[model samples]
Target: MAPVSAPDAALRFVHPDLDRGPEAGLVVAGDGRLALATGMLAIRQSILMLLSTTPGERVRRPDYGCDLHRLVFAPNDETTHGLAMHYVEQAVATWEPRVQVIHIDAHRDPHAEHVMQTELHYRVRRTGIEDSASFGFDLSGGGG
Candidate 1:
């Protein structure tokens, strides 16, 4: 699917300075400053951030996370994979309203020791363009 290019739509999904520069999330322009992230990039980053977080990891937002790490301990099987897909679907639906989840796929890595891969396909609510994100989680050390 064709993704909408940058600098086109109104500024959306503005995020904190993630560059980790001196100003961190803030960028300095000639006249003023801004925190980076626009359009699809911002939405993508937001999804990754949500995925990276473990539930209760955020200080004040206890319910604002993916908790995908729990799959690390689960037995590599279709049931586990199904649960993972459902979990991601629910989390994304609750946490991010800017995009509609089209499909979710979770599967075990047969070649790897203990790894699970999750693919999420989505369509931007405003643009109607499609995009996807893939995540690989290592389950060896943490749980299984």
Candidate 2:
């Protein structure tokens, strides 16, 4: 019999492929094997990593990241939020092919003038699973 190809084997299975962050450090599982994220957890991890990375930060894949960091000093107004949303949408669309972006929103924190809260909504293409991720951007120039 011919060898069972990887793609063929994958098609025969129902579980989604395992996910590991490109920059995430190795994690030890309870069983001693490496831990890997799967399903929605994996997708969420990927989204977080993508958002955290800055374009050109990676040596080999210089273009594999979001540019939201560039707006750190931008005015916390509608224009700034619009630019942030554009950056997020473009980054997610360009770097992550597994999910379709539904919406992106950015708003200044009512309590903190130098903080901007961003929320992202996306749907997994293969399973149609929907989820959201939120993070904050610090504009205080504290350099954390």
**lDDT by residue for model 1 (1-144), tens:** 364455432332323322222433334545564434567877887786787678899999999988677776777778888888888888899998989999999887767757787889999999999999876767664532
TM-score of 2: 0.77
What's the lDDT for all of these models?
0.73, 0.76
Candidate 1 wrong stretches, greater than 4 Å:
1-35, 142-144
* Alpha-carbon shift of residue 82 in model 1 (angstroms): 0.7
Please give the clash total of every predicted structure, in order: 1, 0
Which sections of candidate 2 miss by over 4 Å? 1-27
lDDT of 2 by residue, 12-108 (tens): 1112112223443556667776655556766677777778788898889999999888987888889988988999999999988889999999999
Best by TM-score: 2
What are the TM-scores, per candidate, against the unseen true structure?
A: 0.72, 0.77
